[model samples]
Every structure is written in structure tokens, then in C-alpha cells.
Target: MPYSNIILDMKGICKTFPGVVALSNVDFQLKKGEIHTLMGENGAGKSTLIKVLTGVYQIDDGEIVLNGKEIRITSTGEAQKYGISTVYQEVNLCPNLTVAENIYIGREPMKNHSIDWETINKNAEKLLDLRLNLKIDVKKLLSSYSVAIQQLVAIARAVDISKGILILDEPTSSLDSNEVKELFKAMRKLKDEGMSIVFVTHFLDQVYEISDRITVLRNGKFIGTYEAKKLLRIDLISKMVGKEFNNIESIIKKSRDISFKASEVNFVKATKFGKRGTIEPFDIDIKQGEILGFAGLLGSGRTEVAKLIFGIDKADHGTIKIRSKEYSYIYPLKAIKEGFGFCPEDRKVQGIIGELSIRENIILALQSSMGIFKYLPMKKQEEISEKYVELLKIVTPSIEQRIDNLSGGNQQKVILARWLATNPQLLILDEPTRGIDVGAKSEVMKLVAKLASAGMTIIFISSELQEMVRCCDRIFVLRDRMIIRELIGDEIQEKNIMETIAQGGISYGKN
Candidate 1:
């Protein structure tokens, strides 16, 4: 409704890579003077579609129409020349440089045969003031500024290409409420000035607030586009996942079952586990061959519980028992010695050692458990890593290959292999399937099933209720740092989980 003119149009786009179909016959359109939102789940082909549009990738088929003319953007620079610019989720600006220097790094003003510092700072300040209503010391190092300010700086740089189409990808992921409001204000300003923008984000509230139109993608295919006001959030979610919300009954019945009786709790037991401000005192028990799930929204104390259980964070109260032996305070080393393995939520930051080889990372945690003196010989290390790589179906050229060079799913498998090498009695995986493709997710689920069937106790945590219902034998629903609801057998359904989350863990009756 903002404008009748179409600024950009991507039609019947088809893109593919080895072992993956990123985008297939997808169509996306953006109107002038409107903020269009691209919505999808992880591995929904949002990033691939964006890459194809921005010239980060060359399309295998279909055509792109920009301002009523067919255009093929082969590189980032060429995309910019065609009035298309992108500010990615991660700010790509140099942190050590000044705000002004970062904005105009490669394109600095030259005055009187010298670098024009005065002109650069002045121009940067002017741009920020006019576009984003931001007042900052442009001379200061960009690192000194907060992430919110840096996001604004990135936008200021992108919007400098006047009348251009700016693509903002998950810019609000790390921002607080006030910062997000300020960002929305800046976006509105850009919209008012007749600029077209493609906004990609996972936040539904933000999408409804800022987007004039919504486009949904699912499994490398375009679903449909609708005006923001007309499309309900529930419908959008169903479209993104290719299933209705009410049809989640299928998730409750899984293909795998616990090989050992799940009625007993012998593996790990938390008696009023509390970490003060971190997580409330709660009791949870798991059996040797049981898969327990923790489900909650962001900041709902899911990760906090995992940290407390894994000894990453010291418990302020309560006792943890492993195989009927109580430990009042279990430190990281002690947990490792006690046969506990933890795969952190953030794989890139906490799990993978980017510079190290797959073999090195796989054996690092196991080596720590054995102590420095119990060194694994190079040949033995290769065998251990090779065994897991093949067992886990990790696609790598060799065990010596750098873990960072592999895809996200492969890196996740490496993390799993690392934990598995220790032969831990209990494995705690927090959001293990995040940021991986659907194929990898399936593989990880299968692996979890296999492990549980092998009599290993596993704690699974995920934001996706469907996944929790599918894989977990029993689910503990947490809210505001407390165990509010526990679902078992017939109660363990996606609908039940959603009702608990929405209604403060009260039973909504059987579906």
C-alpha cells in the first residue's frame, strides 16, 4: 500500500549446490517505499536466495528484474552499482578503525592530495544524523561503540547509496528493545524517503511492526507473498514449515524408542538444582536409555539449566547425582571425569576450534579427560577420529581436514564426535540442530535415537516444540527460570507444549 511501483523483482529463481537445493523456482518482489520482510526457518533457503540476489552467487536459472530491466549481478560490486546493497547480520565493519573510517574505508574523500579526515568524519556524522538520527563521535574507534550503534553505522553506510535497495539481514538479533525501536525508526525514515528495503529476520513481532508486505519461503521453495496486515502470524508459521499448526500430532509419534525401560531414573538426577539468578531450584531425573527434553522460549532458562547440569556454571543450591552418587559441587574437570559430555548451544563459539583439524577437535575433550600425561599417539588419534567420522556419517575429505572449512552441519557432527569420543555416561545437547540444513537435522535426530537405543542417557534442548515432541521420551517445560510443567507419554504433544508456554504451564485439557 506504500507504493504502486515495483522496485525489484526476482522470478522463477533456481539455485543449487552439491548435496543441497538452496533455492528452487522462487519469486520475490519488493515495492518502492516499503519495507518487505522475507520470513523463513533455518535452512529455509532465505540466505541462499539473498546471496543469489546480491551477486554473492550466480543463479543457475530464472531472471532478476531491477527497476523494470533484466539484470544479472555477478559480484557484490556490480550489485552495488545497480543500487542494491546489503548489511549482513554480523557487522562487517572494521572495529579497530574510527566510525568515519569504517563507513568510508575503501572510498575516502581525498582533499588537496591528502586523506581528508575532516571531510570523512563530518560527512559520516551528517549521514548518521539525517538518516538514523544518531549522534556519535565519528572520530572514536568503532569498537568503543555498542553493537546497536555499530548496526546503525552499517545501515548509514548502506543507505549512502541514495535511492538504493538496502537488504538488512537479522540486524536486530543482538539488539535490545530500545535499540530495536531506534532501528525501526531509522527504517521508517528510509521508507518515507522512497527507498525499497528487503528485511530478513526470524522475529515475528518485529516483522508485523516494520514490514509492509511479507514473503515466506520453505525448504528452498517460495510459499507466497501477502500484505502484512492481512497475514496472521500463525498462518505464516505454518507456511514457513509447510504444515498447519494443528497438524503437529504426527510429531508426537516417533520412529525410535528407548531400548531400555524409561520408567526408571538411574543415569542422572538433579534434586532441587538451583543456580540462584541463573535458574530456579528444580528436580529432574533421567534414566540410562531415556531422552529427556527441555523446551522454552528464548531467555526462558533452557541454556541456564544445561549449564548448571553440565557444571559449566556452579550450582548455588541443590545436589546432582550421577548413577546414585551425589555431588554437591561438580566443576568442569570433575564433570568430565564423571563421564559427562556437553555440546553447547553456540557451536562456532564454544564447540569448534576453527584452526584445528577434525581429528584434533574430536580428540581434544577426550584428551582433557585423560590428562596431559595420557597422551593419544598420532596414529591412535587418527583411528579414533576416523571411526567417529564414519560412524556419524560426517562428510569430510579426511580426519586431518580443518573443521572450520566444513559446512555447518558437518561442524556440528564434529562436535558430536568430540563428545562421543569421551564415551560419556550422559550427553547434554543444547540446540544441537540449530543453523544446520534439514538433511543434517534428520541425521542428528537419527543419531540421538541411535544413542538412546544404545542405553546412553541424553538431554535434548530445543526451541522447536515439534522436535521436542518427536525426539523426547519426556519433556520438562521451563518458564521464568522454573520447571513449570512436565509432559510424559500421552501429555507429550506439541499442542500441549504450546499451551503450556502460552498459558503459563496450565493444562489445556487433552486434544
Candidate 2:
């Protein structure tokens, strides 16, 4: 229970929107000097509970006790005054300013009615270098530092403002393996200093690495809390997703078993297609009605290649051939007109129109392809949205609901629907299942298999090795912004991919 030295206790927390009961009688407790992780699926009320605790959303019913005293935090300032602070996934500090200036931007030390620049720089340097064991020059612009260092600076500022409690929401989503290690070190140091941390993330491996206690929530209800060491990974997954681990695997296997046959014709033939400083020149041929995968580590040019192919960034070298027609260069509108659709990796920023409704979002690509003058009627839009909403099992009450109101899984479904509506010949999906739950991931994979079986050419890119192995007919192993090796059906195993990534590439002799 980790209750001997309780710092924050939330009981009977309930919150609801117009048609959604976001949180219902949820309970959470935090022990002093410990790292507690909040685990759940996209619609499982993890964010609602954090909002309730941080005063971003007023609870419908509940009580929050901090330091054995009941308190109400009406706003972000009030929460900070009560010794609670939060750092979100994106670094919120100004990159143009010096690291020290960002650390004490609004609240600066004053001497003789002037800002104490020297003292500020020294304290900032000491706090990061000594207190957190992070070595960085505080005088340098924050933009010069990596994302990991910027995140630590944001944490330093939060700790200085509110030292009692810290909430980190998806803090390591953008970080690589090494960067994650650095962040974990800082987290451990803070825990040793008697700070209570509420970590909200989807990366299970990271959760096990840094969490002292784990609290599971599902569908706006409190499941249970357990010591990290005592809770098995499978059990935690089951609790968070309400599915047996074996059953989840079966679902993926079922989709993987769907028979796929490669076509003889090359739907896309790229000859040394690349952009300098992005992805090195590479030649490849994508067959009709097959799923070709691109596997690599973070910053391995997976997204860069996709961007170059889709005309988001025009390639500086080589040529592209679609349906036996050669082209020297292409752009977005031209690609759309040529029956190409792309779903970006970062769905929130690059894919969905948050404020728009599901119907509007679904028709975006189709509308763009048809030209601005060829407006789709409201009735036709409704038909398209309703058809996909049912087909994808989107789980939304109505198509008029804002896309932002839907869960991550449903939002992803809508984005897929947007591409499907255009009936494109070739589709590119980048990390389609990221940041979603296990169930949603399985469903998305199944949908991909179904599409491929129906004679659609697709390019699938994912960081999860198992996913790439399951859905891709052939994979291109990339490293250092170059395609190093290609794995056919039998060779596309997770171990093989890992080995190739570790040892640069597999030896296939001279092709």
C-alpha cells in the first residue's frame, strides 16, 4: 500500500462531461519520497484524475488531502501555492532564452531594484549540476541543448516553485533509450530528496524501471495499487486493459495469420529517392497489395523517408515511378491527386483537426483531393463518416462530436477513415498504434491486415519490433539514415531486427 508516510490522498473522485463519465469514484494515494505510476488505456480516466489533482478540472465529487490537511486548488497558481507542480510531455520552457533565464523567468531574484543575473545563473548551474547531477552550462541558450536536458530544466523550475509534489505526464515519449536513462536518474535523485511523483506514461518498460508503486485505473474506476516489484508486468497489463495477456496475443496472432500474397507488378518503384541530411539515397520497389515496413531506432530516418516520398519534403535526388509513370519531383496535392494517402506519426499535431467534428475530419483528404471548388455536401459527408464510424467501431456517441473529445484510439480510427474515404491506391501509416492501449493496437493491426488482403498497397512504419514482424510482408532495416538491409518473410523476426540494429546490418554477401 505504501501508506505509512502518506503525502497526498484522493478519495471518491468523480468527474463527468456532457455525455462521458470521465472519472467515477476513483481513489489514489501517494507516499512521500516514492515514485508512483498511473497506468491505464486512453479512455481509462488517467488524465481526468491528474486534472482533478492539479485543479485543471474541478471534481464533481471527492476530497483531496495533502499533508493531512484537506485542500482545494482552484487554479494552476493555487496548485503551485499548495506545493503541487506539473510538467507535460512537451517542454514548456522558451528555447530562445538562456537556461538560467528560463529557470527563473517570471520570478527572478532582485538586488538593488534590478534583476540579479549573476546569482540566477550560479543558482541554476548549482541546482542542475549538483542537486540533479545534470551537467549543463546555464548561460547557454536552451535551444542549444537536447530535448532531454530541456526537460530536466523544466523539472528544476517546477521543483523550485513547488517542491512537495511533481506530476510528469508522458515525459519520456520523445526521448531515446539513452535520454530516458538520464531522465530516470534525475527522477531517482528527486525521490531520494523526499518528493512525491505521479508518473503518467504508456511505456511499460519505463514504468517498471522507475516506479516504486503502481496505481491502475480502467474506464474511470480505481482498479488497485501495488508495489512495482510485487506486480508482474502481465498482471499490470491485464489490470490496465481488462484482458488476459494470452488473449491479447491471440488477437494479434489472428490478424497475423491472415493470408497475404505478393503481386508481380511494382506499384511504387523508387530509384535512389532521398533528401540530403535527411535520408541517404535509397532504391526500392513496393509491390502492389503488399505491406512493406520500415524498421529503425528513434531518429533512424523512418519518418524522414516517408516525408520525402509523400512530398512533405521534396527529394533532392533520384526519381519516383508510380504505375509505370516516372516523375522527377512531387508535392502533397500532386501526391493526393495520384491516389496517395499518408497518416503521420504524431497524430495529435500532424493528423487530426482537434476542434473539428468527426465528419469534417473524415472528409478532409477526400475534400482536398476533389479540389476546394468541389465541396462535399453535408449529407454525403454524413454518409461517409457514419459508414466508417460503424466499420471501425469508433465508439463515439455521434459524428458531430469534436474529434478532440474522442479517445486516442477513436481519433486514430477517424484519421484512418480520412484516408480510406479517398480510396487511395497506396497508403503510408507512421506509428499508427503509438500512445494507444493494447486493445486498440490489436484492432488497428487487424484493420491493416484486412486492408492489405483487399489489394491495397501500404507502407507501415513502427518502433515496436513485434508489430513490424507481424504485419509487414517485407521490412527495410535502416540505420544512420540509410537502408542497410532488407528482410523477407522468413527473416523478419524481432531477434533478427535487434541484431541488425546492434551490429549495423546483416551480411547478405554482394547483391
Best by TM-score: 1
User: How many clashing pairs in candidate 1?
Assistant: 0
lDDT of 2 by residue, 1-511 (tens): 4336998999999999987899999999999999999988657898888888888999889899989999887787888889899999999999999999999999999999999999999999988986579888899999999888999999999888876799999888767678889899998888888888999886556778899999999888999999999987657755764655344332124254355686989988888788765677888888999999998765567888888888999998889998868987789998888889999998999999999999999999999999889899999999999999999999899999999999888899999999999998889999999878799998999899889888988999987777887888889988656787899857877656655754666322213
**TM-score of each model, in listed order:** 0.77, 0.67
Candidate 1 wrongly placed segments (more than 4 Å): 245-247, 250-290, 294-335, 343-363, 377-417, 430-455, 461-467, 476-489, 496-511
Question: In model 2, which range of ten residues has the least summed lDDT?
Answer: 245-254
